[model samples]
Target: MSAENELLLIMERISDLTATDAEIAQFNAWCDGFKAQEIQVENFDAVSERVLLQVHRRINKKPNVFLPLYMKLGAAVAVAVFIFSVWFFSSRVKSIEEIRYAADIAPGRTGATLTLGSGKKVNIGLATAGDLAMESGVKISKNASGDIIYTIMPDNKVTADAVNTLETSRGQQTQVQLPDGSRIFLNAASSLTYPASFANKKERRISLSGEGYFEIAKDKAHPFIVDTRGQELKVLGTHFNINAYSTEAVSKTTLLEGSIVVSTATSQQILTPGTELINNGSSLQVKQVDTELAIAWKNNLFLFDNEELGTIMRQVERWYDVEVIFVDGISKERFGGGVSRFDSVSKLLKSLQATGKVQFQIKGRKIYVTK
Candidate 1:
């Protein structure tokens, strides 16, 4: 039978007043497959109590009707979904305790800086939506949506090799459309440098100082290249993410859709879709990886799946633009979960604190971590 048929059978069993043990087991197995996304609850115990109360009300209203185990479980799930949907889809929840710090730290925004070839810095975040600059017969403009677009003139010619850089400071992220029509999303504390135009270039190449997710435009004749600190990724129209933070122990290149060749001084490997190549400054290792977790920053999410405390704090430090100081020393514990990047630092910290493995104190722009 098809999956839909199977699901219907399970639902029938759940709704039946006298479901057998085997039928109840099937219903529970079906319900277990359901998962709610983009929902954050502070007090799960309170939420569960409220949900159970609603389910009891539904049960009490139906006189002479018996609710089996599966029916009760299904009712509980429905009630919980209703409660969380109201909290998540609506405004941010105010139920969580408001943890106060010395200073309020807001979340990051879509912002970056454009460094012209002449060394002049233009704050893209503060600049209005209009023509920003012109270089090598290409017009650079920012749309109302804060996307930096580059329009290459029909008669575009590069007299000199002029390079422009776009950098996002801590607590900022931005998108840029390259002259080649490729789009890139730079994460916090990331930078991308490219030539004014690729008119006469044999290959489209750019340098990235930090993490950037790329959707390379297809060009059969000329390949695209990304140069990190000591690694290079060659692409022929693909979607990928590269995390080459200098502070990171190992640089990573994760392929999402297409193939990519990751090259270092010692080795080179072609990574297939769903493959990740880790460069440890000497050699390259390829392994199957979770593409969603690798490029979660571009989607405004902090997915820490079994990531170390120190690693998670590093990401928080960049997004909050704060300094992390260990009270005694860092813990070796790792965590697995996710939270919205749109949330305040306190909410994210509270989520971490709920694990009971660590504690945090914020003072001004500094975060003190304790175990």
Candidate 2:
């Protein structure tokens, strides 16, 4: 085939349809040739320009076949230039917003709730961990592991009830124990809501946000249920983790110790230990996974196994309570490793930099990414 036809074929493969692996490989090779020529432009602009012009002339001989390819090539080159410029310049002068966005929060951040069971809102955040304080006769205490535990006094009875939830902002995490003996470790940027009393015997339910690990006290008599982002998780009593962060494209429910029934508006799946249910907006898929990886956040660790840069940043944004600024091209890089959530944002970036493909800058709570 002629050079013009080959260029037209590659452009058609990229623009009109999903490119096959072979075609994509060819296109990448072409891109590399352009990149090589670009490197010499600083020292020999005229020579580089002449070479590009000659190539363009040869490829443009067949206007009917080459017009689309020319447009696509132009777009691709523009995108490449934009990506390089952003990464090259932003790395030199870091901003506070960039740093703040990069830091991930360590687990066990301060969190508490205001119980307004009797028309009064109590400040539970200030209450010491494991110390039981009485607010209108409702006993509230922190557990040995810094989880908030609530117990209603046997004699205390009220008609009106309200639970004001306290959640760790991005970059924070906390644990809590329900009145029913169930334990919950809330992930960063997560919240949980429950009533002051178990008042109902048929079922126990709570609302959740972001992500959390749960160890439900087996009460076969009363099935425990979690409501999160339009999904429901039901179990008689079991251990599991639910990640329902609104920012995420999917809601994940991973079973650790017991069986779980996960249901959305249109689908349902029964998940066993070592199995995970992922509900994207359109469909649900259940697959087996390493239970340890799913619960790593509970242990103050950030684990990634071939995870994309965007996914990794979401975890960082939640833990450190920061924002992420992708001022450059979206990173197509995938990473696999484990890092302590306790590390500073800069430290985490340094670890990622070891890969030698991507670099980051942390200014305060923001993180800026470049390549």
Candidate 3:
């Protein structure tokens, strides 16, 4: 293909956010070539850089370059492109937000640790797709999609009430299918402990810490019970999310479908879909909430709706496994935004910085926050 046509295709890929790292590097090289040829852009606006594409109408020779420039979405920046002798060009920049780089940290992925009834820990990420173990008349294995699965063996008597635990550390998350056919998604820095077989149990009981999204299998005969730090949630086949991280003083239970009874030491409350029960370690209050936001972490998203900076950073600390040190005089303003949880820590921090309420600097495994 011709050089000009190739440049157009590259620009399209960039606009669509489909360009590879090498392609981006190539584009940058083209820009350097233009500089070598003594061509310069006349205008570059600092604040609303309304794109002014001024390609020099005259040149000493045909510069072997397809110039490149960056445009941050929601921010204005001028861009120019050049190839061969053709000087006139118009390009549309969209979607690709230029993230500030300070030694880029990679995003998190799916991984977890499973502790068997025998107290042996297995790294699910390194385990092969097969029967990981056998205990309590249930077979523990990992599926092709890397999710843990538990299956009951027919005609096999229930052995000891062997309890197993699945845990995910920071920069990790995982899903598991319980022997009762329920599905639970454990968020980063979370763990779930349950019996290997629910065959003889009156209630399919499980203990949870940190955060989890439960999709309980429909079993009206046996209700499911989740024991957390500050609340006990009982339900008969429903979907819900519980956030009871130890670092936070408040715990929440958000129901997505069906109903759940949340019980504290003194009070008991029922939560319907689209509502959340917040336990402030002193009182329990049920309020209507956006269910999506409550389970946003399970959906691989970080959605903050009028959430405090400290509250938001707490989440960042868990998901990225970073220590947050704050200097004095940081704004107490609440901010709102949505960012992909699977992205690097910088992207999330940059989005928060865009609010003009905070700044971040990464040093080793620590994130320093400033006013």
Candidate 4:
């Protein structure tokens, strides 16, 4: 494409918030070419200043012939963040119209609620980092690292029958160490219910909703069973991730280490490392997959590998604690990239906007997607 067309295309990509990886790569090339042509614009600051001057000059010369409002707005943002490309772009300024419907919601953090067996709720997010509670002969404490630990006393001969639940709301996450030394990292909008002390239980069984990553302590005699949605994962000792969000199309169980037997009402399969068992309705399928991408949320990163725009937005909706509403319907375009979960939703949305396939309008905490 010609230089003018290429610039317009980049601006268009920025406006629509649907820029593809290849398009972003091409934009970076253009930025390099611009730098080579004008050596004075050596760094991001210089590029931002030059782009700002150029944008103002264009507006001054042909103020009546500006691009569409959205395009102009997007282009302005793209120009501002051109130096950083896909990974980091936070210098963009919001237009007056865009600001009217802007959302400033922060990303999810380490926060959750602990429900004692007595139905009392303790907001762990607000609780101090010390002894949280003692429930059912199990000593529950919050360590300095904000991790919940359950320690059972040796001398106390009380096998109490009580179950405790840990839940994380939208824009929050929490980790808990079970009595058996197993660790569970609960994701936002997820919950895990288990017995306070597993001493009397036949098996280490836990029920999960939403999503969580598990690292089961090795105990071949007492198998660890996870009940999620309509599927059950049976393993002796393993590390895996389960994504059973109600809004998700399917329930997925990805294994990272050890072995697991994933079963449903209709089918069963054995999964090894680097494998995932997907449950769609009553059907089950197993396939080799990338475990890192599956557990990206636990690592504080949003990793999307060829995921549909609608699918990508669903994750964004949960992490940013926002609502997503498609203007006509969901955008079918797919996205592939990774961004820090701690960044503003605008930065993430701006990266998507560069794809040149879809557009986004944030009104309060709701995101409207359109083509």
Clashing pairs in 3: none
Deviation (Å) of 216 in candidate 2? 0.3
TM-score of each candidate structure, all chains considered together: 0.73, 0.68, 0.73, 0.75
- Best candidate, TM-score-wise? 4
Please give the distance, in angstroms, between residue 135's alpha carbon in candidate 3 and its true position after superposition. Answer: 0.9
Best by lDDT: 4
Counted clashes in each candidate structure: 0, 25, 0, 9
Q: How accurate is candidate 3 locally (lDDT)?
A: 0.75
Compose the digit string of candidate 3's lDDT tens values, residues 1-371.
64444554665555444454445555555555554655443433321122212223112123223323333432232333223222222222221334224455676788899998899999998888888998988889998888999998896787647999899999889999988799999998999999988887778999999999999998988999999996799999899999999988789899999999999899999988999998998899999999999889989999999998888888887888888888665457799989998799888877887665666667678877776
Q: Supply the TM-score for candidate 2.
A: 0.68
| Model 1: per-residue Cα lDDT over 119-160, one tens digit each | 878899999999998887888999998999988877756543
Write the residue-wise lDDT of candidate 2 on 1-371 in tens digits. 75444644555544322334355456555555555554222323233233334334433433244333433555445445433432332232233223333444333355544444444544445565565555534577775556677776788773224554646666557787777788888887778877655654478888898899999999888889999988889998899999998889898999988898888899888999999998987788999999888899998888888888898888877777777888687798999888787776666766676676675656566677877
**CA lDDT scores, all candidates in order:** 0.77, 0.67, 0.75, 0.78
| Segments in model 4 whose C-alpha atoms lie over 4 Å from true places | 1-102
Candidate 4: which pairs clash?
17-352, 17-353, 18-353, 18-355, 18-356, 19-354, 19-355, 19-356, 20-355
Tell me the spans in candidate 2 whose CA falls farther than 4 Å from its real position.
1-108, 112-115, 118-125, 130-137, 155-160
Q: Give the TM-score of candidate 1.
A: 0.73
